[model samples]
Target: MNNPVISVQNVDAHYGERQVLFDVNLDVMPGEIVVIMGGSGSGKSTLLKHLLGLQVPTSGSILVHGKSLHDVSKKELKQLRKKMGVAFQGGALLSSLTVAENVSLPLEYNTDLDQNTIDIMVRLKLELMNLGGFGHLMPAELSGGMLKRAGLARAVIMDPNVLFFDEPSAGLDPVTSVELDELILKLRDAMNITMVIVTHELDSAFKIADRIMVLLDGKVVQVGTVEEIKRSDDERIQNLINRRPRSNQLHGDAYLQRLVNGEGEK
Candidate 1:
């Protein structure tokens, strides 16, 4: 593949003393959906924070467009971040703002566009998210699934080159989750945007990911296409994919140490 839009190399992250990501290396090719998945305490959230520049890795580095985020000037970092979008889990909408206003906030703050133009642009995005005519509704008025779509609309409102989604399928009914997955696929197809998704829904991961990275206890165990992962012989990979319980012996004192370090055992 061409040089990745996002490159993570030998990244080790820590919460105080407890390392959460151990020498994790991955790449996100443009226009591909790469899902980072694992159970709780797997460190997927930490990886996402690393990507978003919210947390610094204890070692190694993350590079976007060949520029390392480690120690970059704040001005440069802000500009780099402008090219990305994030749809956080739980909608993350402001309780005080209407959907149109929430989506318009980015353009209003980031651009020189007039109110009329911003309004038009926000409406266009809401329409693209299949949320047409619902722009005036408050987040509280929408269903769980509609809320997700609204969040997506806001994320892509700026036409970012890279989009990151956190647990897009979480807490929704199966049908709603499936609908969100389809919307994810459609976004990639229509916009050709690079997508990094963090989710544990096996069916959603299988359906939408071009590649999947499975992390376990702060370490990356496997990274492959859906078929490759499904056929993986790694016992942990099998346990995860098959929805089998982790062996208690496997979750021993090492796990406890990791938990004690900072990431408490779940």
Candidate 2:
């Protein structure tokens, strides 16, 4: 990855005494779409939080555009955040604000731009997202897919260099999910933004990712192109792709011990 936009180096994360991520490492290049995929308890969420600078790693470092985040000042971190954008899984829109107002919130709080300029920029982004006329509508008035699009519009409103998404296709129908995948590809290309997505949705990841990073048991199991992943002979990878239920012999005593020791919490 030449001129990588993100670099994670031997990162290990912990929750209390239990380590959740084990020596994770990856790099994301400019204008590329990288998907981080794993099932529940795979430590994907922990990785995302670390990348967003919401938590510090217990060991190792994360660098965004060559700026180390482990011990950066708050002001410096805020400047780095200004170059990043996130589309949460829930489409977290404020119910009281109109779509246009919601979309304008970033520019309103982050810049000295006036109402007229913010509104114009908001409309432009909404139009780019295929929601130009819907800006006047409330978030409640939007369908699930439309709401996701609205969220995407707001995320890219700042023209961020790195865009992150969490489960962008979680609740939508298949067709809607596919449509959103297309929109994601379009946004990365048109805006020249590096996209990092975390999801359990295999189809969407396979369709949209330039490279896929697979995780298991708090460690990266594999990182490969879509075709390479399909060709993988790893049983874990094959089981995940096939959605095959496992008959792992987890003894009842071990399960009880985990619960007794409070090790079940993620």
lDDT of 2 by residue, 1-266 (tens): 28789999999999999999999999998898999998888998889999999899999999999988877888999999999999989789999999988889899889999889888999999998899899999999999999999999999999999999999999999999999999999998898999999999999999999999999889989999999998999888888888875447669998889889988475
Local accuracy by lDDT, each model: 0.92, 0.92
- The C-alpha stretches of model 2 lying farther than 4 A from their native spots are 249-266
Cα deviation at 10, candidate 2, in Å, is: 0.5
- Candidate 1 residue 119 Cα shift, in angstroms, is 0.9
TM-score of every prediction relative to native: 0.93, 0.93
Candidate 2 accuracy as lDDT: 0.92
TM-score of candidate 1 on Cα atoms, chains taken together: 0.93
Candidate 1 residues lying further than 4 Å off, grouped into runs, are 248-266
